[model samples]
Target chain A: MTAASDAPQVRIDGLQYCNWSREIFREMRQGGLTAVHATVGYHEGFRETVRHLVDWRTRFRDNEDLILLARDSGDIERARATNRTAIFLGLQNPMPIEDDIGLIEMLFDLGIRFMQLTYNNQSLLGCGWMEKEDSGVTRMGREAIAEMNRLGMIIDLSHAGERTALEAISLSQRPVVISHANPRWLCDSNRNVSRTVLQALRQQQGLLGLSLYPLHLPNGSDTTLRQFGEMAAEAAQIMGAEHLGIGSDLCQGQPDSVVRWMREGRWTRQAQAAASFPPQPSWFGSNLDFPKVSEGLRSAGFGEAETSFVLGAAWHRFITVSLPSAV
Target chain B: MTAASDAPQVRIDGLQYCNWSREIFREMRQGGLTAVHATVGYHEGFRETVRHLVDWRTRFRDNEDLILLARDSGDIERARATNRTAIFLGLQNPMPIEDDIGLIEMLFDLGIRFMQLTYNNQSLLGCGWMEKEDSGVTRMGREAIAEMNRLGMIIDLSHAGERTALEAISLSQRPVVISHANPRWLCDSNRNVSRTVLQALRQQQGLLGLSLYPLHLPNGSDTTLRQFGEMAAEAAQIMGAEHLGIGSDLCQGQPDSVVRWMREGRWTRQAQAAASFPPQPSWFGSNLDFPKVSEGLRSAGFGEAETSFVLGAAWHRFITVSLPSAV
Candidate 1:
């Protein structure tokens, strides 16, 4: 067994869309997290998305000691040195870009580092996981991919369909990422990726952020820490150790309404009955449970170097390579 | 000689980015223009573009008797029957769509019909006329074209570079258009379409709206009505009479700042020394000059059928095919 001193020093959550507050910021600091890819927009348009940014600006100003905006990898390093959690802004859907391709630059200028092409339905760029048919990357989707690649924005394919995710991986000049999802071979769901996608991601030197969302796990809410850790080890075996990282899709403090809003945006009128606030497993309840995951990784036989990589260094390497040097 | 009765009954200026007002609306009525493609955005982003739309909504409500928003070709027919000029909203640049391709559907819902891939500089979609090197239509530009085609939004390539314009014409599933530009064979500026681009446009059944902007005219401010008409006749011979029309590029009542705004958006920091507003040619000034252009077309020996087509019918046919039937 690894000694207590062999524990990961820098922990980074590859993806989290929490209802952020001072309480959550304190939790992150307590959890010893160096940085987090925090989602800012799901189905929000440009104006609404801007409002979210403004809110973040206010949060940064208010919680200067606890959190700072992470625009690039350098900021993540600064956060580590200062003992603050670096919050990197991301968008789960490309709605903020609207139909104008030029807005990609504008959003990049505003400090958005990652953007997904689709959420759970068909977008102008490509098919979502929830779409009836996967048509692959559309003509506009191809253009958006090029622009995103040119601007150094990480293309997140968490909620995309299999064909779209594969095409995006192939089309991007830079390394793309599945910011939050597991392999469908582990748990059968449209939201999870296939083995083909995982193989493609591994081949392309991209990253697969293992999700801890209850619905995405093999045993759902009953999943144990050992099972989750074993799954990670299995994923690492397939995707290689360097490509695996944790992106706990933890919705800390969010209500049922927010879940409904996320599942059914302005695109739909019907209430999504199945997408109610999911009961998170007791072993992994919140940000404070991050250390328990590290413990589980050690139990799964990940060495000191591998545990450190899966905890944070892998994500740090990814941001260093994926993000632009300047904001 | 064609009689006075042979005068164009349905005059439609294919492109204009006028400083729109009640006075301009009255002038459009005086000019006997049945419809116009009025540019709403040049360099504005999504929020600013929405503000412009709001302003137009107010203008339409205030001047209900003089003008109406043209959502489709049917609106144009209704405008002609009602004796009100139909104002079809267009974007001189695709900045309004920002980076979200899904906004294309939203903007279409809001009544935007025509959109240019670029204005006077490099955009996410394609290179503009002023770029040092034209790399052709970008990947995002290709997807944008496909989306525009699927949504029935007319792809306008007025200010795009030669290679970009040619590529757009070839790549578009539907017929594209150069909403305001002269043939470079007649005018030796980069702002004008090259003979190769014009030939491709003609072959692909695309329309070229002849620009009357002084800088685009062969003799600049000294260009005579006869010279302009003769140039049109020469162009008609090359592009065929059916594909030729008048966009005019009339900038009536706009301030010099608006001109500067068009030439230099947020993309550049250096002041545009040569982008100062040029003097309008005396022979062709504002909306009132429509009648004189018709007389010149007659003087150039065009038949009544050809004159009518050049004035409006061609644009009418193009819009009828390019816009969705519902709106």
Candidate 2:
């Protein structure tokens, strides 16, 4: 391992939803991760999602040496001081809240600091990226967003469609984030954000964590680390260095069946036969390989301070602003 | 409004926990209710509680003129040929399937015909009626009481105590019903079950659904119904009367606060300060007063066909043999 002084100053991955285990925790330590915004729920409803929280509590207890639950930016700082990776809970879908608006406060109390309004279809809140007609945020979505803003929870729009994403940007009183998505200018997938959204995100002082999932990469799974880093540099030129950071969207150690569940949930009766786990790019396979992207950013003509900011400090700054002061 | 000849023959009041609309489905077609089980859930888990089914997709649309989601006894012969009142869904506590159990075939497919393990305290599977030391259910109770035996899903042990109820009558190979409790002779409380549990119910294939909701009313709630019907004389007899019936744990047109939550759901942070509703014993205050309970049993005492059995037959017959042939 490199000397402690050589490590990036504040290495936080803006998002990850790995099949977490002690091995992964060790890899986060190896990767010099200060913290991770970990996805806790997608299509899971409230009670089932509480079970997930219980599972995470067990994990936190079992792995106390390597990780701690991060409730605030100060927790992240404490993790860095203790040489542990802080895991902040996030949700990729609003299904956990179900139809009840009161549950927003309940979930926030349970340590969920971030939540997306939709996943890949029409939700009670908003439309997902895959929905054909984006009606923007629904009536319930507006109430939920207002509650989230009051509680200072980050509104994520990573899986939201064009109009919904844009509307959320305009509606949210607090700055929001596209926690894991590339610019559509770089990767033409529906999962990536358009240039217009990026401009609005920058205007609103929102953060954009560039994704490294294969499908969102320009050259898919064959994309080189250097090429990926250069794309980050180009995105920084459009959205500025202060808003750019890495959110690998990593799916390390997950089986193929889990991928199907993540996509299909219980929304449909039939299995999503066509959907399967894609091959991860060789340049960045897991938390252990996070340093490769940091190194690539350096090699892509970024200065020392700018590289550190893009690597993690940008996300740290965003979180410090996003999370509630009291919570 | 109909003549006595045109009135529905069967009348059952298995249970009810409605946030009752005052309209009352035309007073259950003026009190000729063929069957009524009519209770939803208590301390239910969020997603799996089948609120969608309770929302009554079919009842709200196609079958509004006839029934209310009874999955038994041919929907009470199609609500006595469209006069309408067949509402059979029972749940006393939330501990039936727990989380690990696979939604139970009877619950998911057949719509939860009946479930009662506990209502007063901690129950991994058993122990109710406020035991000082809840030893919890025996190993068999842990195995699959939620799975429901082949005959039908009627496992009511109304406010049972620890050891007696948790033993579950030697793990119950077929089906069992305590339908309602008036058993101070067994344990001495509003929540006791008498030696009849060991006797008539086991030997004669009888059911028991006797409750007036004024806490085991021998004298409470004015006690007139007891004398008017010779309830003591009939109950002293063997359980040959097809297991007796009338679980009138009724609270109709209750205030919204009464239904704010059945138990203090996890949604609330504070304990419910005023935990009890007002007294409700003005001679069957709702569902058009259920006059059959008063008039029929009185005439039956003069050597009719045991009007208690008539009052109970539809429910007993429904539960004795089977749940719905299909959902």
Query: Per-prediction DockQ, in order?
Result: 0.03, 0.04
Off by over 4 Å in 2: A1-8, A268-274, B1-126, B130-327
Tell me the docking grade of candidate 1. incorrect
DockQ of 2: 0.04
| Root-mean-square deviation per candidate | 19.9, 16.3
B238, model 1: CA deviation in Å?
62
Give the alpha carbon lDDT tens digit for every residue of A1-327 in model 2: 677566547888988988899999999999899999999978898777766876777788799999998888889878988899999999999998889776776577667899999998999999999988999999999999999998888999999999999999999999999999998978898889998999899999998999998889999999988888888988898878888888889988888887888889988888875577789988788898887787788878888878877888899999888886542
Estimate the TM-score of every prediction. 0.54, 0.57
Q: Please, what is the whole-model Cα lDDT of each candidate in the order they appear?
A: 0.87, 0.74
lDDT of 2 at B109: 40
Tens-digit per-residue lDDT, B229-315, candidate 1? 888898898787778889999888888888888877777787787676678889777787787887777888888888888888888
